[model samples]
Target chain A: MLLLGKNTQKSVLIAGLAACLLAAPAQAEEIWVSNEKDDTISVIDVATMEVIRTLPTGERPRGIVFSHDYSVLYICASDSDTVQVMDPVSGEILHDLPSGEDPEQFVLHPDNRHLYIANEDDAITTVVDVVTRTVVAQIDVGIEPEGMAVSPDGKYVITTSETTNMAHWIDTQTQELVANTLVDSRPRHAEFTKNGTQLWVSAEIGGTLSVFDVETKAKEVTLEFAVKGVHPDRVQPVGFEFTEDEKTAFVALGPANHVAVVNADTYEVEEYILVGRRVWHMAFNADKSLLFTTNGVSGDVTVIDVASRKAIKTIKVGRFPWGAALRP
Target chain B: MFLRTVLALCLSASAATADVSVVIHYLRQDIEQPPVLSNLDPIPEDLGLRGAELALKENTTTGRFLGQTYTMEVTHVPPGGDLPAAARSALALTDLIVLDAPAEALLAVADLPEAANALIFNASAPDDSLRGADCRANLLHSLPSNAMRTDALAQFLVQRRWDDLALIAGTHPDDIAFADALHGSLTKFGLRLRSEKTWAFDADMRRTASQEVPLFTQDLRDHDILLIADEIHDFGRYIAYNTWDPRPVAGSEGLVPVTWSHVVEQWGAAQLQSRFDKLADRPMRSRDYAAWAAVRSIGEAVTRTGSGDTAALRTFLLGPDFELAGFKGRPMSYRNWNGQLRQPIPLVTDRALVAQAPLEGFLHQTSELDTLGQDRPESACTAF
Candidate 1:
């Protein structure tokens, strides 16, 4: 069930403000990047394209996400095996949640209170409730679960295990696996479509993306990317995001060092925009006018202009940056 | 989790028979080594065997869900023991054999008539001949060959534009073989060997390392990097700072190209380290990883093909569809031509991963991993 809370109201207000400020471009949002090696978060002001602040985090922070209302942030400090809740405004850590071992990536359900975390070492998906800071359920999953995602309808959550090569689907209401869908070797990330009809899973080592019919849990398509002058082994597809209208998708090809613009309707690659080395994940600005990619090898974020399809600026961050999220 | 998986299997088995049964035989013969000069710990006694054990545990965990039973029988031959006879008996029981033996012993067992339907994994020997003229159809190599290690170093050197190199090789047989392998890569990468020397001193290195090393390398030609080829973990540790020209030492010493290292903490490897450490109580080594991969390959083949038939498993392993999550950032697959597992070689120092090869811009027509070792065109074996 979707919450009729300030999160929804704030999104509407942010969208309206984005539209009005499109011409002048004075207001600012922040692209927060999690540095896996340095244990820091580099906050980049959208207006200036510069790193505004570098805040300390728990050891080896990898995955990061903002609350829907843009009030707080969740950082997965992987090595510490705990999730830190931080006030984005004050840059103060509120407290830590009981995340299982090696929490690499996670998803915030539409309800905004439940977080599904992927515990890589334990092979368990730990669902935590934010209000009580208590673990809701610890569901046993496949080996080496790395990526976590929730459906738009908030009915199911998916965990992509790197070793098991399967996407384990858990029914949110029951907190148990309803389906286990096989993907290619080493599935790294998964996401549902905006309409919640399709589930997209990226297999990092397989160098392909698997799309499934969400209702039937059957694979609909397998998408492969081939960047010119790049070897097939290096063309690893990881994190992905869609355009505002859901017509086009921008996928981060890990180690291939490029982002592929794809036609969502046809499932065809349109163009490859070169980025930094070993790009892991991405986050779009509030207006969808800018895409920021965290390059793990280069330790920087490559900001791409969404309309022009060109890299506008490179903002240096801490070492081995893994994930990016927008707070608008 | 294992208990849960087993419980689920018990519930499923009540309705159906356990269909898939896989039995593996693991063999090893640790050869004598020169006393290591450095103070670091020696290799673990269960180097290759513990890896096979870990893989067995993993296989059973996955097999529990798929209604399969997996087991591995281990036999470690004493040094200078009759390895071939022991291997013959081990091969008679099962077709899947994981071996950690010398090249001669592996070749001897591979040539056995009783091993006609068997698949053997070369998990210890880094010999190049096994990947070349003496290659066997039934044999698969999980360990990186000597050529792969040297080629990885060559790629890192080329990426750094370190063209001219000087070589200091120990007198051990493995050291000579590693140096021989490096010579081929230096020629292939168009790098110059400005000076080459073999260690001939008989003094105790701990007492006279600083005094003897500098004078030994003083007359050498100018070079950009110093290459040490001491595979026995013997004399190379003393050659780093004692080199006359202050060149960076690499190869088997300061900076190394390895199949697996404790320093590899990226790309889901940290979890693997934690898992292995939990099971073995120590960091995983190269041989352990190779042996683990060998056992897991069989497990993957049987799980995917849904049968214990040797031909089917072999076909699946050598096919293009085979992909193993090796925790090396790249999905590894066996080379169909020579049965060598294709993987990324990590170039590391003592405490950090410096880089992984093939480095940027080292492109290949097929796979970037193919550039590290013997490609199809250069491979001498007609066996697959």
Candidate 2:
């Protein structure tokens, strides 16, 4: 049955991490943004905050993530129906993995050997063996699976289905759906706390952020946005981030042009930091000192200082910048 | 490691499957004569049913991955047929029903005790009363009501500063209903009805009397636009360029407010149009879009909840947790007060789309789409 109890899979991940001690400290230290319309990935130097090189790739490059050791980068080239692997240093194509169909987003396993990819159109979550570059398992999920998050403990992998309006919880060990927790409409992203106690999902059209208890999978609270001059319809909650300390969060309010800083424990929306138009996904730099947001319509990335919660810079990017990820 | 992987594969393979059955019940009102139109083709035999079938296949594409499969059973009843009996038979089979019938027949089917536990989608009937005083707890409408369509046009006219309207209505039941809706919109938007007239001509315009059609529309008072209410397609299309005062014609003629149109090419609508065109071998109509939306609503619910239980689905659908992407550049959801779907109405000409209503200035507390129809404050429906 679905909604099974949480399995004890953390020990397995901890043991795996113990073996890869050398790869932990030598971080990649780079920022990559996928320009959806450009079908290319732009790498930025973490120290300089400047574009190093633009690597051409598949049809629609929406999601990008670096492998745990930072030797390889996996790009979910959605329109091409494959996830392309590339060497970060030389920017050379390593291989292409059959990632179901329309791979919009993916989460690399903590074990550093398997990758969980969300196929947007086909409603399937394919788990691929990174070493073999072959699909290990394909789990059925809801329609338009866009956002994926692996728990800190690595026991559960949750994929937020946009059309289905639910965050499907998949047991990592069994590769079967354990629970379908209904959220608001058009959930674009999901992020778990560093401690893995709570999961936050952004519902873009529903104009709310839902917080859920990780173990029980019960909705704890729903937060709504109210910008002073903006209409409620424009206050679409999209991608969000939870600080490493799990005390604060920054949620990108698309079309509203604001990022809401929320109190993680109290679930209080503290302030709305203004940003660019149609602000989408966000990423934190190496030290969590700077937060970068890809503004789709405005074609720029707004950089926010984490300490002051103020936007400091707006860097121009390619057309329709969608998602961003940082390696350190 | 190999043993654990093998065991995991076995466990996932034995996972439970979620199967949902959706039944479409339509009352085919038999008529002795169909409309005689020279320019446009006659209405198809399988108008709404074909759309539901296409959506079933679309749903199955995604459903197969979730271990969910959708099956549609269509029951067609003849004129003066036992619609209630047919609805009862279908209700016994599935709790998810799509009704492609008239207002009265839909109400009869909804009033059944067995349908209390069902989640019904109204695919065809566009009567305002269905979303107003006669709304049911089980019935969810995908089709936009007459009030919504008229309000959409009125909003556009107000935005364009076309304050004066010359209203002409035919002597048909549906025409009268549309006329009433137009009058309501005029009052809602503070527009002036410069002149109102009724046409009683029954002569065939395809024959020698075609010249008289234009002559009949002449001599109207000062008006910026001519709004025709001819649901029977008798004179709406003919009055476009033949209007007496050289005014633009709308409301079922030159520039119409519709639920869906083949001309809509924005917000990924081309993908749906192309997919539907490949399936139906013709351009998709408003009725087809309505039916497709109805089935997709159910498919969305089942995919989210992972259960076909009617009570859970109904609760989730009526609650804030429901919204379906209808290829309108926005997410469409149901209004809790009345089960009408709150969506943007596209104003389209024959060749290209003009604009979507609930236009920029139209404001609402909850959603802008509420401005296009009977909002929660003005809704008289409390059935649910």
- Fnat (0 to 1) per candidate: 0.23, 0.10
Tens digits of lDDT, candidate 1, B135-167: 999999999999998999999888889999999
- In CAPRI terms, model 2 is classed as incorrect
What tens-digit string does per-residue lDDT give for candidate 2 at A1-328?
0000112353343345445645655544567888988988777676667777888888878888877656788888888889999887788888898788788888876687878888876667888888886788887676667788888778888888776666888889888777777677778888877467888899887788988888677788899888988877668888888665668989999888999999988888899999998888988875578888989889888889999999988887788888887755
- TM per candidate comes to 0.90, 0.77
Task: Tell me the docking grade of candidate 1.
Answer: acceptable
What's the lDDT for residue B360 in model 2?
85
- Model 1 chain B is weakest, by summed lDDT over 10 consecutive residues, at B6-15
lDDT (C-alpha) at residue B309 in model 2: 82
Score residue A299 of candidate 1 by CA lDDT. 92
Over the stretch B14-55, how does candidate 2's per-residue lDDT look in tens digits? 223455543444334333333534546687777777778778
